[model samples]
Structure formats: C-alpha cells, structure tokens
Target: MTKPLPPRNDRHKSSGGFSLIELMIAITLGLMIMTGLVTIFVKNSQARTEIERNNRQLESGRYAMNLLTEDLRMAGYFSSFNPDELVISVNAPPLGPNSAPVTPAMTARPDPCDTTVANLNNTYFFHVQGYDYPYTSAALPTCISDVRTGSDVLVIRRLATCVAGPTLEAGCDALPNGAPYFQASNCFQATELARNTGSRLDYLSHFVLNTDITLATLRTISCLTSFGAPAPAADYRRYLTHIYFVANNNVGSDGIPTLKRAELGAGGYTIVPLVEGIETIQFEYGIGNTANSAKIDAYTADPNTYNACASTACLLNWLHTYSVKVNLLARNVEQSPGWTDNKVYALGLKADGSANVFPASGTYGDRYKRHAYNAVVRLDNPSGRVTP
Candidate 1:
C-alpha cells in the first residue's frame, strides 16, 4: 500500500546510469592523462640514456689524459742512466778507444716499432719522440696497422722502475731470454780503468742497450773485478718501448676510435687497446732553448723540423724537449638523441692566440657529444737532470 502511493511521483524520477555525453567526457579525460604519463616516461628514459653516455665519455677522456700525462713524465727513465750521461759522450770530441761511437745521419723521426738491435742502438738516444698527422712519407712502423688519420703518435722509451732478470725482484717477473735487456755501467770496464781521468759516463761504449747480452760485460755498482776475479753480473732491467696512438678500430673494425698502445715485448711489438672513444690525440712539444735547459722556452706542434736536426744535433733537439702538451678529443660511444655537435671545442693553444680546434675544420657536423681533455706534463726524468 505504501509503494502504490510513491508511484504518483514517477515524472520526477532520478537517473541510475551515466548519460552518453558524460561518458564521452570521462573517456576523453582518461586518454589525455595516459598520453601525459607516456610522454613523461619517454622523456625520463631519454634523459637516463644521455646521462649514461656522458658519464662514460667523461671517464674515458680523463683516464686517457691522466695516462698520457703521467707516462710523459716518466718518458726517459733508464734506472741509473740519464740523458745527461748520454749527452757528454755523444756531443764531446773523441777522446780514446772508449770514446763516442760513430753516429748515423739524422732522420726526422725514428721507427717506433723497430725492434732490431741495430735500429734500437741507432735510436736509443731519442728516448721520447712524437709524430704529427702521420701518413704517406711520414708513416709510422708497419706494426702500427690501424693508425687513425689526422691523429698524432707518441713513442716513450724507459726501463722498468723495479729490477728485472737474470734475477727477479719480489714483484716483477723475469723477462724471457730473447727479450731486450739493458744494463748501464755504474762500474767501468778494464779499458776505462786505465784512463781513470774521465767519469764512467765519458765512454759511450760501456752501456748494454742492445738485445745481444752475450758480451754485455757491464758490471754492477760493486767494482769487484780484482785483476783475475770475475765481476758480479749486472742486474739488468727490461727495456720498455711504448707507442701510443689513436687507432681506427678497437677489434675487427668496430669503428670505435680507441687509444691503442703498441708495446715492445719478448715476441716483438704487440698491439693492445687502451681507452676507447678517444677520437683524436694531438701533442704540442715544449722545447727548451738550450741543450741543458730545464724550462720551456718555446712550443712547437711539429718537432720534426728536418732541416734543424742534423746528426748529433737531431738528438739534441729531441733531448731538449722539456715538456709535452697532451690534447685528446673524446666522444660518446653512441649518438645522442636530438643532439648535434655543431659547437667548436678548443683543446690546445694556437700560435695566433686562438684555441686549437679539432676535425681540422670549423666544427664536427655529427650527433655524438664530444669533450676535450688537455694537460701539460713536464718531462721530469730528462728536465730534472738539467739546471734551471
């Protein structure tokens, strides 16, 4: 009876479901919110990828810069032998039977991969050398098979800081028999004993620089060769020759510009990849004005002024290099999204007071982000031995 009374207000009834207009508006709002969320997700993902690439690029560039800079400081370390000792013999006039050896004609650059004993003997005077934009007539050794075009190559020669063998130190392993070993004479030979007028460094023939150690009769610090008793065998060190350059590929033509090191070993020159994404390496040499200068008087991009270096003079020019400016152009391994490397980046300094830019042109028209790392490293081993 109560429900029959309420049926009289049926014209004022409330709706129990959404109308078509309200449903359409609700669906449109839902789609807009989903689209915004998707856009945010995409932007975040891209931002994350860009951050990773930048971090990797930064690591590679700084590591390379530090490596080159630190190694450059250790360029001419040969245990007890200094370039100062070499300077006296090669420059002074012939004194006697144990005087300066006959020097060869000057070549602008020596082959970094030349492991032949003869070649080693000839170029041992130049402990450090660099080649700028090597190609055609200025090509490096054939051992360097993948040198990137328009990049510089650096050669560093030194001895192991620790002792090497015949006998082994606690940390270092003995070098194989055929590998080149060096033993400089702190104690002189019988020929040098007769003419005690000069120092041990006076004779150029006393050092064991070549691989042929059969007649390497140089002695240790102990001058124990009493008339008949044999002198103690010298503790020789592993002669290290490293050539650093930018190679076109890392492994099997990957197209990743890598900093490759061709290190001299028992077998010969062995190539190995170091830091990757190092697109270009350029060096500016800080040349000292005098033979014994410990400071940089002038800087030159090209040390191979062929006309300037003649015979022993050539050795002097390279020996006088007191410092090196290392410039490395490093880039991201992958292309950045919505990015263009149209900006000109300066690495080193130019003669006209501007910065030295890469690609040899105005800018790099590419998508990869790049950064330049540079450091001026002093040649401590060589420059320290000289008076400022």
Candidate 2:
C-alpha cells in the first residue's frame, strides 16, 4: 500500500545536496585557508614594523652625523682671526692697520732646538673667566632649563675632562672645541680674574681645550707663568702657550637650547648647534701626512705651534694643522624603544672601510635610542685635508 518513492531525479544522480562528511570536509578546508591567511598577514605586519624601526634609526643617525660633521669642519674658522690659531688673547694687543709692530709680549720666547722656531712669548692665546653654560642660544631648538650660571657652570666644567678627578688642571680649563662653561666660576677663576684687568678684552680671554671633556664641572689652571709651571696666573700673565676652543651646553630664557662659544674676547660665542640630541661629545686627535692618517693616541694639552720664545711670532705657523677626527654622541629625548643591536646601514657607509654605526654598542642609556658617531672630519672644508 505505501506510496513508492519517486524515481531518483537526474540531479540526485549527481552530487545532490552534500553528505555530512562533505560538509565537514569543506568547513575544515575553509578554516585551514583562513588560518594561513591570518598568519601571513600577522607576519607581514611584524616585518613591516621592524623595517620601519630600522629605517628610522638609520635616518636619525645620518642626520646627527651631518650636523656634527658640518660644525666640526668649521672648528676654528673665525672671521676675525685670519688664521684660527692667532686667536685674540685676554690681553691680546690691538693690531694697528697692519698686523705689525707685533706686541713684544706675545712674541717673547726662550731659544728652541730649531733656530727657525718662533718665539713662544709673542704667541697670543685667549683666556676665559669661565665658559658659558650654553655657548650660544641659537644652537638649540628648545630649552628645558634656565641658562646655567656661576658654580653650576663650573660644576659642568669639572665633570667634563679627559679623565676624572676633583683637582682643576690645565686640561679642565675649558671644554674641548665644543663644550660649555659657567659664570661665577668662570669669571671668578684665578685666570679669568687675572686676565680680567680692565673692562677691555685685552686681559680677559675665553679658554678652549685641545680635547673633548665630559661636561659636569670644570677644573682649570691658569696659563703657566712659564710653559712648565703647574699653575699659571689667572690671566695667564705669567705665560700662555696656546688657546683651545671651549664649547658650552645651555638653554636660554627664550627656551632655545644652545652651545655657548667665547673666543677669548673680541670673538664672543656665536652659537651653532652641531646637532640636536647631542648630550655630550668626545674627540680623537688626527695628525700625519695625506698618504696615511695618524691619530695622536695620547691627549696633548696644547697643540699651538711649539714656538719656544715668549714674544712675537706668526700665528699662522702654529695654525698649520691639516686634519682632525671628530667623535660625537647624540641622544633622543623622546622616550621610545631602542634598537636591539648595532646597525650598519647601506645608505651611509662611505667607500672607505669606515662605516658609521648606529645605536652604539651598548644598552640604551635612555628608553630612547642613543647614537654615537665617529668621523674623520677634514678641518679644511674647501680642500679635503686633515687640519690639526
């Protein structure tokens, strides 16, 4: 009696709807495909993030290097001083229309092994009461603290040195080429006070160190009475062999970060920020011929021409240095994750074996990246020669 099922349809002969097995299989395949896609997407995102980070670090490093190199190139270039080393002194005598009838004092000297040796006395050297906290307000884009004064400036000077110790020495007198100095300590110093005879810049001078020292507090010894005296008069009236460039770190009332510069006197500091994020600086001296470069491993307190006399000599003779090697360390103030390893970027490596490394070879001192750079900066900008 039961009704017989209709004859199977042609469609039914084919795959019909799906069997449970088929349905399960299809679902499994779709899930597997989705998992693979998601994994690819995640991996891609991570890779992109890492790539971006590396690129940023590389760019930051290059930018910092460019800034530092440019300033280093101009190390001792001054419009006033025809030859950079003939820097005006604390009591540097004014030159007549012609740089003649040289002051007997600057050229006075003791005999040297070489007859051609210039007089040490006649060499005019600049002195600084103390270096400015920030040599120039224009150097910085933004400032966090007020311009440091007096002891604070001296503290920075003391902290900055080739090596550490409390005693103020000739080495601590000024920050190497680009460091800072304080006020009270700077002006009150025996040399600064000694050199600061009259309001005129003749006696007062700014101090410059031959090497880079850490900036915290400065230790200073007046120019020697003679070349070898342990301590010289504050003014260096007794004797002064050479003057070094002093660089300063400071913030101005205008809220600009800057590096202070004082060229003994006539040439007051003109702030030029070699680079931003530069918390400190160090230097390695370079000397030798064009064929092969040589770095003076030992720190030389003075690089002025070794003229033995006390009075008149050509400042240019001492300015004969042709090359220099500059080392710079910059820090990012913004808190951010730093790189895991030292990176060598393809873009910045020069043809020479030398390569500029990024993130330095240490844990980030800050949460953000801190990069250090070392470059053999040619002092002569026009000609690629190493300057002393």
Candidate 3:
C-alpha cells in the first residue's frame, strides 16, 4: 500500500475555506430578514382587527341615534292643543269643595275658555268624577285630546295664557245641581252636560264623552292662579316628562342574550346595554342657536340649564331650538386579534351619530401600536324648548 499518499492537502484546504467572521455576517443577514417579515405580518393583522371593531361601534351608534331623534322631535306635539301648550288632567278638586269642582266637562273644554256651549273654560277641566265617553262605535278615534287609555274621569286641565285656574266655583265645577260637572263652552248645538244614569257612575267610571285626543298624553299639568277669578295673572307652571332607551341590560360575561321592549308610562327605567364592546358614551351640548355655528361644551347632568342658557326664560329665548353633540367610545372586549394596544383617536360626530373624521388617532399602548376614536355629534331635535 503506498500509505494513502498522505491524505490529499487539497481536501483539507477546501474544508477550512470559510472564516468565522463571514459565517457570522451571513447568519446575521438571514435573521434580519426573518425579523422584518414577522413584524410586517403582525402589524397587518392588528390593523384588520381594529377596522372591524370600529365598524361595529359605528353601526350600533347610528341605529340608536335615529330612534331617539324621531321620538324627541315629536315632543310637545298634540293634535288638539296648540303646538305650544298641552292639556292634561288632575285628580282632586281645584282647591277644595269651595275652591273648584274640576269636573270632566269643565276641564275638557276645548280652548282655554270658550263662552258658547261647545266651548268651556278652555278645552281642559278638573273632574274628580272622571270623563266617561262611551266607545259607542268602533270608528271612534283612538285618543281623546291628549289622554288615551286609562281612567276616563280625570280633572281636566289646560296650559295656556287664556285659560286659568284650579278653581271649582267658576271653572272646575261641572254643575251647581250637585250632579258631577259644570259647563264652560258650547260648539254649535253641543251640550257640556250628559244625562246618564246616576247608579251607573261606578260602571261608567272608565268611559269618556265624545272627545278629542292626540299623540300621547300631556306629561304635566299646572294649576295656575289668576287675577280674574282664575283667569290669568299667575301663569301655569309645568310638569316633567322624560324617556330612556337601553338594551337588555341582562348581558352576562357570556354576552347579551335578549331584546328589550319599550315601556310606555313611567316606572323603573330598565338599564340598557350599549354595544357589546362599547365602554362609555360622552355627550356635548351646543351653547349656540341651531341655525348658527355652535360652541361645543362638556356634557352636564342637566342639559337644559347648562346649554339652554341658564334658566327656562333664557332657554326659550332662542328661535325655539338648539343643537346637541354626542360622543361614543367603543372597545374590543375580546381583543379578538390580541390588538388591545392603546390608540387615541380624535373624531367628530354628525346629527345621526356617525363619525365624520373617521380613524383619527394619537400614540397609545405599551407598544405604541394601537388606535382609538373620539367622536363629536350634533342632535337635530333640540327645540330650545323649556323643560317645563
């Protein structure tokens, strides 16, 4: 054997060619490329998640706002009473037996006070006996003036400059015959008194005479004092009314499970659920007039006093209107894509609760890689109307 000819030196040289420094450089470059690709993928995913969350928030806000607008616009609107005032009823006598009778006929008179048989001391009165108009025909209109369902005999009352009193003697009393009412006005051949059976009072408790009704009962009644024997010296004060909207607050850690129905009269206002992921809602009121540019202000518990110019008188001084601003904040409770990084957004809202500036943002979160939104909205139905 020629002794393997001293292993080829060329083979050894080939194996030793690559230096440590060159190997290190190659490895570093590969790692850098891999790192860049991973970062790009993460950012893209986060962005997509945020967009979806935002869309959901926007949709929910819009729907809620629309419903609120329609209802609020219809405030104070009734078919019978003028657009400015609404007529309602009371329970007890005006002041007392000597004070005023406040029967159905006396209170339900159409205008503040009409002299004719069809007319009475205003179309409103105070009848403790309650009004009992028979639904003789199915064709009868649904509502009687502002009062609809419920007890028929109520103390009729009105809100106006012309009509006056909680007095039973001149206005509230339906009749001096000790029957159950006093007359105020007459329209054409219309008579204020009705000749029903005496014993039927209990059975007829829920009935009302042929009367007018409109869209919703007047929320308040004011027993005004007057100089002309309850005529109009001291003006009629007001009662309060309010409405609340909410989802089925019954949502659990699992999620919202049911729909909520609106409750008509007043009672325990059901707590409503906001959007599934929404955390809060902020509101702003325009201190200026509806027609002009408004100066947005922080929301107050009592919007009327703050934005409505301090007092009822000042509030009503406007052209009968003001504007509203709203802000909605939504969150990804699930952080679906693990994109909970914080991002602050500055945005504006329209009358219908839609964000106009859209995805505005400020740096946020530990990674400084998240985004958020701030919205400002305007309310269209602000009538600058006094809460009274």
Candidate 4:
C-alpha cells in the first residue's frame, strides 16, 4: 500500500534549469565575444586618432609652405618703379634742417660674414635677405627669445599691391585736423600717421609710385592742400616688411614648435603664429652668375658666403640670387606612446649625400614623429631684374 503512489508519470520527469557546466560554458563564450569586441573597438579608435594626427600635421605643413611661397613671390615688388633708381629726399622747409639724400648705395654696409647678418636692418634696394642659423642671441637679439635654435631666418620687403587715392576724393577723406593722407588711382584711402609729428616723413615711410607711366616719385601731399584739389592718381602702394622664423615654443611650456611671422603693423612689428609643429627650418640660396649669364651657378647654405661683400660692388652679388631652397622639419602635435624617433633626417644637400641630420647634437629620445618638406622657390622679382 505504501508503494501505491500514483503511477509515476514517466513523461513528466522533474524539470530543472541548466546544469552548472552549461552555465559556465555560456558565460565563458559570452566573455570571449565581449573581449574580442572591446579589442576591435580600442584598435579602431587608436587608428583613427593616429590618422587624424597625421592629417593635421600634413595640413599645417602645407599651410606653412604656402604662406612662405606667397610672400617670397611678392618680395621686392614696387609696381612699375625701379627700386635701384630710388632716391629718397627728406626735405621739409618747416622742419628747418633738410635731411641728406638717402640713396640705395648709402644703405650698403660691409658684410660681416657671420651670424650677425640677422641683426642687420633691411638695407638692400630690392629688400630680400636671409640669415642662416640665426637663432643665436647675437644674431637675432629681438627674436632670440622665441626663435628655435639652429634655424634660418628670412626677411622680405615689398610694397602693398593695393593703391590709395587722394585724401580729398570721395572715398579718400582726409583724417581729422586736416592731416595729410594718401589716395591711389583707384580711390583707396590711407591715413597719415598722427604720431609722426615730425615735419619731414622718414624715407622708409614714403611710397614711390609710377604715376604717369614715365615718372616715379614718392607720393606726398601737404595738409594745407589736402582739401584744395584731388591729387593725381598715385599708382603706388605702401611699404611692407615681413620676417619669418621658427619659434621654440607656441603655448606655455608645451614645447610645441611653431612657424612665426613678424609683420609691420600700426605699432611696429607684430609677431603672429603661422603654423604649429614646425620644429626646424633651413634655407639655401642659388646664386646666379649675372656677370656671365643670368643662370644659377652655385648653392650655399651660409649667409656669409651668400652675402660676401667688402664694398658696394661686392654687395651687388646678393642681387644675383635667383632661388631659395627651403627645408622644413615638421613634428607631430602630440607625443606617440612608446615610440622612438632615432633616425637621422636629411634636410638638404650633403657632401656625401649624408650628414645634415636633424637634432644635430644629442638624440631626441622623444616619442614625436617628424617629416622633412623640401621646396625650391624661384625668386621672380630678383631674377627678372639684374643689376649690371
């Protein structure tokens, strides 16, 4: 009787959940899948980051090159006026004493044949000069604080393309107090400097123009005559000076190198950051044999050799320069993790096709990647007009 349990329902066995081994196996498979996905995601993210960094570097490099090239092309431009014939006469009867004539020949100084070239002012009539390895304090006292060591400096002087019309014209209204102003043939306006209280304007401030297609003279108007009549169309422009160099750092102590430009501004030269991650810059000049043939003959990296001159006759050698070889070393914005940059980078021409390594001294031992950009920029303005 005790065994008389309801007939054991063979079809309805006790139901239970998964076994311990099955649960463990499912968990293990899930964990493996999750780990693989995570790995894929991390790798993809890292790759994207690297790609973006490289793109940024390339874009910055291109921008730096374009800026330099554009400025170089416009160097020494003075409209249709001949810079060699420029003779600045600072004469002001009201100022009492007349300044001695300032000719291009007077601006020539004996070439010191050293890094001191960077300290020299813009003297050449066709104002274009460079300093090789101009980072030393003695060479660039004004810019040494920001300049990167072992880098070249380039200077360019020219006239602005735009022209201003007479101050009395419609669009060229004179400033307050009957101050003298300038106006180009196209009716552009340029106000006179109020701070330039001196009766005679500085020779550097005057803009020489080819007004009648036959004569070129400094455009000047007296304040008394500013409202009398419209001045003849002045086809000339304003003077411009630009200096370019590489800075050791850009923001704080981040040590991010940058390409900086110093441009003539209202308050004098103003420093501006052009491109970031430019570690070093080098320049080589190709001097043309103007005496024999107007063709480039030699390339030199030393400013002293390129500007070698004992007198005005020798100074003419600088005008023979036809082209500039620009070499820029650009670096990554951020440091790469667990990476080393130990390779020697060639900048330009070498004796045995070697040397010219970057970091010139000790190994960087840094995690930053670098690349070299080389470009040969032809100087159209200088090459076109050669001094006899």
Over the full model, what C-alpha lDDT does candidate 3 score relative to the true structure?
0.31
TM agreement with the true structure for every prediction: 0.82, 0.37, 0.34, 0.71
lDDT of 2 by residue, 209-270 (tens): 22223322222343333575444222211111111221335343332223232222111223
Error (Å) of candidate 2 at residue 231 is: 49
Provide the global lDDT of candidate 2 against the true structure. Answer: 0.34
Of the candidates shown, which would achieve the greatest TM-score relative to the real structure?
A: 1
> Which candidate wins on lDDT?
1
The CA lDDT at 74 in model 1 is 80
- What TM-score should be assigned to candidate 1? 0.82
Q: Write the per-residue lDDT of candidate 4 for residues 133-204, one digit (tens) a residue.
A: 633567663633578877887877666655433323345322222111222222222333212233223323
Query: Can you give the lDDT of residue 190 in candidate 1?
Result: 59
lDDT of 3 by residue, 147-223 (tens): 22211111222222122222323333221221112212111111211212322112111122112222111121221
Where model 2 places Cα greater than 4 Å from the true spot, the runs are 1-15, 79-91, 94-280, 285-324, 329-372, 381-388
* TM-score ranking from best candidate downward: 1, 4, 2, 3
- Poorest lDDT segment (10 consecutive residues) of candidate 2: 150-159
- Please give the lDDT score at residue 340 for candidate 2: 42
lDDT at 343, model 1: 81
